[model samples]
Target: MSHKIIRSLLEGRLKAWAAARSPALRIAYQNVVFSPAASETYLRAFLLPAGTNSNDLAGAHRLYTGLFQITIVAPAGGGTGAAESLADELAALFPLYDRLTKTGFSVQVMTPVEPGPEQQGDTAFALPVSFQYRADTT
Candidate 1:
């Protein structure tokens, strides 16, 4: 499948996660909401093609590298650690090594490149997460 399809799936998963925590966290960003207007909560999932090389079609199938960036944003109210709480809920949605697969492509692994940020600033919390997945575009 194309990267666009994969991205849509990722967005769906993110929205589903937020919906599950609507009552407690009140996640406002069902999609990737990035705005200065500011209500309270926001989240965005961005996917980019990191790099692609021949994984060898000689075997049976062809594999490609698909990297994605997931950024979760939340309000930073007071010094009361509101952002951290949001981060925790967000983390629960995408646990380590979560496997996401679809037709014509499959994510063999989802690995975090770096530690997710707990807080971005005094106004909002940002969790920047990266993952590399292997896609079989056969």
Candidate 2:
């Protein structure tokens, strides 16, 4: 239950940010059906929940941690400048120590956003950006 709430809160933030952009970027959410146009730039969001554990012997407190990753997909041969700029914006969106709270649950961004190596395929370049998050419950 807590995991679902955490995911919702985090994903909500990302969705809102994307929607508010000047030229909204299409997003492929987990398990959602989405097909971008051939030359379009978009984003893919993933929530990788590590697991939840009791914070104490009493089991009254719990801790949840996970990695949230977003991949920026751009047209091949378009150069990396656009992808890199988007990565920078995403990193700023979820800065270290940021906190998200809803319905009495709170999640914190535990690390700086990190960008992974770019992967080039026949049709697109995929740049992955990710960060760690932690949530605590009583």
Q: Which structure among the candidates has the greatest TM-score?
A: 2
Off by over 4 Å in 1: 24-37, 57-61, 112-114, 117-122
lDDT of 1 at 8: 61
**Residue 103 accuracy (lDDT) in model 1:** 60
List the candidates' TM-scores in order: 0.66, 0.97
- Model 2: weakest 10-residue lDDT segment is 1-10
Model 2: lDDT to the true structure: 0.93
User: 1-138, model 1: which lDDT tens digit per residue?
Assistant: 456666766656766776776453333333545454364665556677655555565765555667665665666654435545655555565666776666645464466544365555866767666667666664
**Tens digits of per-residue lDDT for model 2, 1-138:** 787887898889999999999899888999999999999999999999997899788899889999999999999999999999999999899989999999778999999999999999999999999999999888
lDDT of each: 0.58, 0.93
RMSD in Å for model 1: 4.0
Best by lDDT: 2
Residue 70 displacement in candidate 2 (angstroms) = 0.5
Cand. 1 TM to true fold:
0.66
